[model samples]
Target: MSKLILLFGGLLIACLSLSANAAPLNPLLAPLSALTAKDIAIIANDADPMSLQIADYYQHRRGVPADQMIHIRFNPKTKVLSRLEFAVQKKRVDEKTPAHVQAFVLSWMQPYRVDCMSITTAFATGFDEAFCAKGCELTRKSPYFNSISSLPFRDYGLRPTMMLAGNSFEDVKALIDRGIAADFSQPKGSAYLLKTADKARSSRAVFFPKIAEGFKGVWPVFYMEKEFIKGQDDVMFYFTGLTQVPYINENRYPPGAIADHLTSAGGVLSGSKQMNILDWLKAGATASYGAVVEPCNFPPKFPHPGVLMANYLRGSSLIEAYWKSVGMPGQGVFVGEPLARPFAYPSK
Candidate 1:
């Protein structure tokens, strides 16, 4: 990749040499530390019982300071929120958010979209049509993409947001517990980068060789040319692309594990013709990403495996790593425990 394309917001790509068998290149600037509970603000909707319940559970589990909670009320049964409806509510969140809060945990699942923009992107960048595309075109690029700053909002005026999403209240609770269980307890786990036969979906395979080489001695980066992974017990990170992935339930996803399949409407969270990222979460993965709208097959729209691992293994939280991986995130939703850092050292 050219330096101009890899570069963003005045940050250089640090010589991204992707040639096979080449010396490792630096992909991420090591952040000072992963985001802690205190750095994240919780936004809960009073109208949704599930929203309120999840917020309370997350706050209690993560030890989020009571003052950091921001409450808003809206009918939570709808599938999408219009720009006006979202702007009014977003104002409340931005106004009430504590200055120290660096990121947001949206404690609900519904209203995943604001017009054409995903709600996560809406919250992260506000409702801007510049992020929406008419067809096969580029959208807004995130200033936080592949960035080194641990405090995104403080550094770039962007608060990376994540949803504590699940099929049921119990599922969300388990997700939170997994994140808590993962902190500072870095396990020896495998990072699976599967390159499937589906050419369009597997456009990301071009990035695997360099990722594997860079992470060789530090973490086990397995670049496999398989359609799907099954029966593996040590899975910590898994990335691939497909409309509907199979055998997801067959593998073991350790606590704090992050996985995703790049496909349209995977961010829909439910009722889409394609498989959603929630499948990974339910199958034991801590976090995943998918576009809420049809973002075409642009590799920048999905999580770059290299960027994801580079940040995550360096002790950035799940939200930070996942958000940084995607160059353009206007169409996607990020779901997971925001503060799952399995590889973090306590002293850092």
Candidate 2:
């Protein structure tokens, strides 16, 4: 009996040691303490690679606590109280394990009532309906709803399948008629996007002034860089809805003269820096685009050499097309034609 007791004590020590060596889940949440709100905003708006970089940055800096983990026990009755207490197990349950530290950081939000939406499940392969519906709900409930009236968020819930294939304002109007929060006002009434006057209608800028005008206050929402600035029609959405910092680019060039120019014009310039997407992913929160690709700068595919040169000269790190698919704060992807610049990366 004494020998058996000794053996159990040895096992407990081993378990504790193993738990100490495990990795963390939310590595980026910690280091974020050092980052300014402007920096966080920058990374949050950048594509998926940069968003992940922000996540990783906090992970390494803050790490996870052993108490916030998953564990297992066989006592014939796995009670909820025991399960929550023994959540941090020493052994890894899955090879594709979340970094031990990450789990702790993610769990931290639970205590604060800040629920991190399950984007993976939301955008899962068979959950298309849920995806569209959730997107609509979020847009409606979010404080920034008024800014994105031109977006087809309302149609997603009513015609989930149709939305998967892309949609138009007419399609959404039908959904709006069916009571899907479709009331939109631009410049208080009409003639915002549909303005006949060339000057009122002209200007290759979207999102910034338009959304700012629409919301009448700054409300954070998904933001794109180059695309928002190139199309004069794009700016109309802002005028009709709630958007904040309309001039702020999601992915921006370094803090310098170029950034000032883009902001003033309600445009963004990407590819000005030589940042590696993967490294940015590792950083957890602070990432940026390079300098050259401003709004209306990079044309659709097969852009002229002059366009490419312009991008190169600006020192922008043009994100590879595929990397920009996953958007953040929410997983909103642009299904438009080839002209659409890289979209946002979803926050995991």
Candidate 3:
């Protein structure tokens, strides 16, 4: 009878150990305690597919619940490129998607205060060869340049491109807002518009039911740069990284396929405003339709997994710093705060 009791106890311990090992881990915050701010920032904003994976790893490892992660942000660099992130914050604003959304927004706006000289300087050399021949000037004489002459380059939210109206931020924001409100899976058209209206109506109805009711037929319209969407390495990177988790829905691509797409030549080179000119080579002026599928050359796996790991650690550190600076954690991760000064929102 004593031996039988001992055997049962041993089996119980073994079962407990196996069950503990089977539980999933969080990637984002687990690595945080050892990382620096710079590394955290890099990992948070890494262009690799494993960004969110990094985030989740850290969160789970630290025993931080998903609801405790009040905010998130891409690296500072992503904001410079206008790769906007979106999220819906919780009312208490902890460990929710809102923090991630806010962090990305603040990072996206960092370049707004860039110095005029530096902004012009950055573009001057490239513009001379690229646009001077086409009668474009970086000086105040050009209306496009003139509008931003007095402001710092950092103040520029979105750069003017050759789009129908050039770098259209309103168009971009509208599209993102509409997409999120529409739950990301909505098809393009009136369905999205009606969903957007429903959100606004609900919000307004709480305070002004009659007024909200009167505002009917209002619809959301949006436009976005094809290049931004097509060249979205961060999106593919984050989604793929999350897939590394056991059961996350985003893990559709075979383990290495996403990394391949991110570093591919076609993925990297195909989305530039200037590089689009290359497509003309594959087609003619009058040709109606065709597709040029080229690919980029990148490492089969991460060129430096160690460096990638270090950077992710650094980015998480910055996120911690931003929250501390704010005194209270707000929605989304923020490296820094915006100035009180108001800037014009881009409009058509």
In terms of lDDT, the best-performing candidate is 1
Give per-residue CA lDDT, model 1, range 1-348, as digits (tens).
122122221221232222222223243234337889889999999999999999999999889999999999999887899999999999999899889888999999898889999889899888999889999898878878766676788788889999998889999999999999999887879999988888888877877876776665567889989899889998998998888989999999889999998788799976689998888999999999989999998888888877777667777888998888888889999999989998787862
RMSD of each: 5.0, 24.7, 24.5
* Model 3 TM-score, 2 decimals: 0.18
**Candidate 1 Cα RMSD (Å):** 5.0
For TM-score, the strongest prediction is 1
Cα lDDT tens digits, model 3, 1-348, are: 122122222322222111112211122222223121111111132332333343444344333344433344434333222211221111112232322122222112222211111111122111122211112122211221111111212233221110000022332233223212222121111100011122311221121222122212321122211111222211211111110112213222111111111111211112432222112111111000000121111111111111111212222222222111111110111111111001111122
In model 3, the runs with Cα more than 4 Å from the true position are: 1-102, 106-166, 184-348
For each candidate in turn, the TM-score is 0.91, 0.20, 0.18
Error of 3 at 122 (Å): 19
lDDT values, one for every candidate = 0.83, 0.19, 0.20
Poorly placed runs, candidate 2 (over 4 Å): 1-60, 70-205, 210-348
State how far residue 102 of model 1 sits from its true place (Å).
0.7
Q: Relative to the unseen true structure, what is the C-alpha lDDT of residue 162 in candidate 2, on a scale of 0 to 100?
A: 6
